[model samples]
Target: MTKDHYWPKALSKFWMDNEGKVCRLSSEGDLVRGAPAKFGVVGNHHYIDLEGPWSHSIESSFQAADDRISFVVDALNSLEAKPSNEEMAYMKRFKAGSFDSKSKNDFAESIASLIVRSPGFRHKLTLEQKAFRNEFLPDLPFRDSNDLKVLELRNIQIKYPEMIASLRASGKIIVMFSDSREFIFGEGFLQDIDGPNPLLPCKCFVPLTPGMAIAFVRPSGPYFSMPEVVTIQLTPNEVNLCNEITQIYSRRYIYFRSEQPVISKEFTDNVYYFLDYSKHPWMDGLLAAAVNFEDN
Candidate 1:
């Protein structure tokens, strides 16, 4: 359409498909799968746009982090709160570059993405990402360019198997990875079978690499349907083991790719879980609208 061309009225926003690809709902009812949409879950809504089609798409949750320097600007303008001169200056630089031009990288190796992989993108950090790290972590060990340069460094995935093993390593338990899908965290990796029923037919444990875990479940129901997810606090050793596992597996994924645009920070978690059910950090339908990504 030209500048003065009449355009059809339609909704052009983001939504998730059966698989977790960020799809762009075009104005003409066309299903163009795999549009790159940056998402800020939790309580963050600082939209940081750069170049390319990526700049055109953004999704923020209701409870998005209030860390955008712009928020401060709005509040100050609206008489919400006051910042010192230094604070104002920092806010200027922060907004110009991003909420967090130089902040800690708080993602575990199991879930690390552009902030750790792509320098071009990491050079531009998001505001929500900044808040999450500052709130949860005091300092990040791997932020320097030289430290991130160690591309071979594999962040551990999980070390929970040992702890779980110590306490009933073979007990039947529901493994709720997220709010939408419910899979039993079976005791050992058994994903050779991708069943028709992802919620009810999964029978094996998820594969564990560094940062990932290899749990051994003692099946409660040989034919169990959807499982429940439990929150387990891991010990130092267990955490270390998970990272060890994640390191081995992170290598398998070298890029942040979707259907068409191939975005990042969306799929650094379990590759099997994503490929198995199209689950991305930002692609959950309900989550895309409500709640935020898990507190991992």
Candidate 2:
């Protein structure tokens, strides 16, 4: 089979190898081998692996995934995928069967780094609350991945319904994809709600906000980051009590989206992809807060 016939046919999947290193193996899409895409949507052109020294620059991975990175990120920016004309348009561009690999690869660094939710954000000048304020805002004008400004916040919110409701009732959620579990949405705010109750087992009232990096997505295709949460600050001992007591972290790889074509980081954040939100069971309110940002 030729490249055109096979790439659209296979679906890509990611998993961890025994060495604890992240490995991505495809179920199909090898041009030499004729295998069809098992999933409904056409293949993401799924190439781009971010690991090792190159994790800082996924140039090789983009070369490998055929640059599905640029396609998806581009499609996401101007067009909203709907079942009607919009969705069809997205697929047309996605499966256009030809790509300017050279140009796209030149722009690969935009989505090169995955924002992380590591312990560093809390104490360091990087990823700190003040850092977030200095760098990001409710509304960011368009900018390409090359000039992309992004921030990643970890352990953002809880999955429970009551918690989500409490967050929504508050306006202008203040989490900022930063360290505090503060939600300042429409009318009410989670920062005022008090973070997760340390007294309860398995209940993260103030769950650590997922590490989310909010960046500028240039029309030329540098993608931005997304996240949602209202964390309850806990002391190290309290954190240990919660860890010894309940499962708070969202299962990795099982519940997050990636830059694809490139593995950007080691862990997952708490936000849902905008492309996934409409159909996602309980994420409408959260999506609104994140997308509704405007320069004040």
Candidate 3:
């Protein structure tokens, strides 16, 4: 009976309005407001019916990660400025150094966990697994849905730690401060371009608050390489691009703190894709691969 928040409530609180509710633009093009605790949650989403009474431990771990990372987020949100790029580069290193290692690690793992445990990621995984089964193991007995759920949930638990380690080894953290409060994010914070694997994301972009975001940059990533830790300012165009990505990647709803006037029509125009699995944004690659396999 452990209700797990796929979108961690602690992080969602960042987008809350003065009324203590966040505005949610649903995939069906409906705008609604609700408390973070009620939204973005699923009953027993992370529960693994394992022995030793540790089925609820994953929720606890997520909560712990959220608690630790909230301080880092609050500190970032406090940075309200429009520094020039040169000044940003000069001051960013110092800003990055101010945070302790535990906070950074917790933030990293929290982002990874969110991606891994998301409903969108789970759907994509199911499609890929089904494709594998249909093509290679056609005669294999179909597994029970509950069994698969347990297996996936358990896999998330196992891979969570590994993902944190991978992020530490393969990527450097960067925080971006936005001059405009126009920034927004969704349940699917990281775009499809972020990575094919949730456990090993590359070039991930996560909006921490309307005024700030955090990213992980790989040495081989498209962006210019930087130090292990850095802070930077986002150009207005870059902020727009991030918001666009958020719109497409979000399967459930897009959360925002921007005023009602700023909730553009483009945000709700493509309502069909998210609600329909056949047209799911995350499935385009999988669909293309299936076509290639069939042709081959």
Candidate 4:
């Protein structure tokens, strides 16, 4: 059989099997339930749920799977260049660490180091590692409210129900919120709402007053050295699109239509490409997706 024909089939089968198995492995924690040993007054009972632990385990599994997928993809793309002995050893270490059956922290530093050494995956992995570290060992010292900007909104109402409905129908809009910032949209927002809604399918718009928005800034600290602000902006169409894309693709790999430049030659050649590409496909995509906005 030809390489092209065989390879596609192989890839499809591999992806199918791995995706299912990974999903199942990640969900194993969820299958087990926890029951509390004590009961509460007024016919109320308390139980210590294992959901949190289960969720953590699932998240770890997903991260490991993602890392493995990236490595495989990179290897496939570089079929012409066989891996060196050292590289093969590193790959083995990575595979072992991914399923080490220990806490994510146990393998985080090593995996991060390995990922940084690749030119294709450094940026994405860096972002993922940062998020993981933040979740596990939040740099509380970096969380100062002084740098945050607070905004308020009032007298907000839904205006364009039709538009909202259309977006929801197309799996675009999840949830719409009116805030001090333009508006905010979150994934699966619409689906989570339980009630008889009167908003039109495509014409509904969530309205807001001046005090509805809030912007929080990440304070300067060792963990979060750079200052960043998160603004809640929601518009019917924008929310729909954002939610749709987020649902369809992992946030790390999704590219949005924004003013922010996806990539720059100076940024890519100097910083990004030199890092590991196996874990940072998004970075590669970013560089590839960049347009010469300067000309336009």
Candidate 5:
């Protein structure tokens, strides 16, 4: 069986430290550093059928999309707060032209790949499939296929192509940078802004590097007329919020480029407490109150 990387190495490589390895903080707060290849990998993660010959079609698509986006990300990595006129012009051109049609499709495919290629997503797929099978096909002969078969149903390239297409068709891509604060990435951090609905997120955020991140905002209501690609520097509080979101939504490990931990132990404790609190019905009222308090 082939080893597949759920997190594309190209993207993960951006988080490398001075020693050329990424720092990973586990949910339990154990910190470790390793090469990009050491994490986000699973054997036959894209494998669809045991009886069928192995194919690289899906992996190839991921590679193609990653290769294209790597250029954009690389440019973002080298970007400065006060860009030269040429650089600014290039960014403007990219906003006006590159983020349309085929390029936009590539961007969407890349984001969708990150979401659906994770172990968390696979597990979700497994549970949903198991539920459906139990409810409607309990007696079917193939209903008891191994977990591998069930999990592979999350191959986004095949099963959820429309998600990529949907991303391409709508939403503005915002590229945010921070000179004062660093950003952290989580294993399953492509989170829905409104809630847990992944298929149609009102907004979503992904931190590409310690200095940069991206968000896809559905263009409607208050967010109408948003540009196709927006590049802006984030406030320190906004940067913290991005890291907090990654921590809350992460399945297990959070990755960063920092040598020392960027997030505090107290913050982690609060995040765990919030996670527990979120399970109760009254958490909504609590959250509303917190938001109202913040507004005041």
Candidate 6:
């Protein structure tokens, strides 16, 4: 008589028939005669070394394969929903009172397109300019430093008193650009005041690298009740300054508030002017003299 191999052909056929539906494989060797009463779990849990005829049984492997497929699908879906590192970085830059090159370019292009589309809008633009001058210009000191250089002129103007007052009240660090050169400096209040020396030492001047400029202004009172506006402007010269400054002061140490969204053209223009003057101190001095009418 031929010896019967322990292969379970009937169970293998049952698994192949119900491919999609859930099913369990029995640990018994066979059902026709020598099959055991209870089935055992397949794969690593049972430590059953499925081989040859038993390995080919579809019923023996379906459960494990299905579980693995489900896990892979869920993992892929999660990855799709998560934000990438680059996207996060861009969002951070927007929030931290800075504009990336692409954003700046897009903004400039949009403005240019608007101007081209409406030639007659020039009068309205002039009126808006005059209105801004009457309302907001008074608070700010007119650029008067002879050593400062005026790189580009925009129709916007800032109110100085409001800016300083807002800064002091908000308790945020105040960064100032010298009108005469591309040097940027910051100041912050001290935690403890001792009589006469209450105000802390002024922070070191950080040179505004050419082609880049940033200004952060908080208009609302403390508690961050109102959102701050961050303006960033860039030009060829400003870009150079940015490179030089970055080398001196690593970019990681630079911190500017990101909560405020920038709105006004005046703020953007001021940043441009600050960056220009910072690079050329001689031009700043000349600007001051010009304002005083000394050269004339």
What is each predicted model's overall lDDT from 0 to 1? 0.23, 0.22, 0.59, 0.21, 0.59, 0.24
Model 6: residues >4 Å from true position, as ranges?
Answer: 1-85, 89-158, 171-208, 219-221, 224-296
Question: How well does each candidate superpose onto the true structure, as a TM-score?
Answer: 0.20, 0.18, 0.73, 0.16, 0.70, 0.17
Ranking by TM-score: 3, 5, 1, 2, 6, 4
Residue lDDT tens for model 1, 205-279: 232111122221222223321221122223343333332322222211221112222222322332322124323
TM-score of candidate 3 to 2 decimals: 0.73
Global CA lDDT of candidate 1, please?
0.23
Give the root-mean-square deviation of each candidate in angstroms. Answer: 23.9, 23.0, 9.1, 24.4, 8.1, 33.1
Best by lDDT: 3
Per residue, candidate 5 scores C-alpha lDDT tens digits across 7-59 of: 78888887788889988777767888889768777786676664556533356
lDDT of 6 at 160: 19
Backbone clashes in candidate 5 total 0
Question: In candidate 2, how many Å is residue 17 off?
Answer: 18
Q: Which digits, one per residue and each the tens of the lDDT, describe model 2 over residues 73-180?
A: 342232221222222222121111111434233222222211111112112322343455557853653243222212121122121222233222222221212222
Task: Write one digit per residue (lDDT tens) for candidate 6, span 54-145.
Answer: 42222232233222332322221222111112223222222112223433333222222222112122233344555665688767533542
TM-score of 2: 0.18
Candidate achieving higher lDDT, 2 or 5:
5
Q: Model 4's lDDT to the true fold? A: 0.21
Root-mean-square deviation of Cα positions for candidate 1 versus the true structure, in angstroms:
23.9
**Residue-level error in angstroms, candidate 1, position 38:** 10
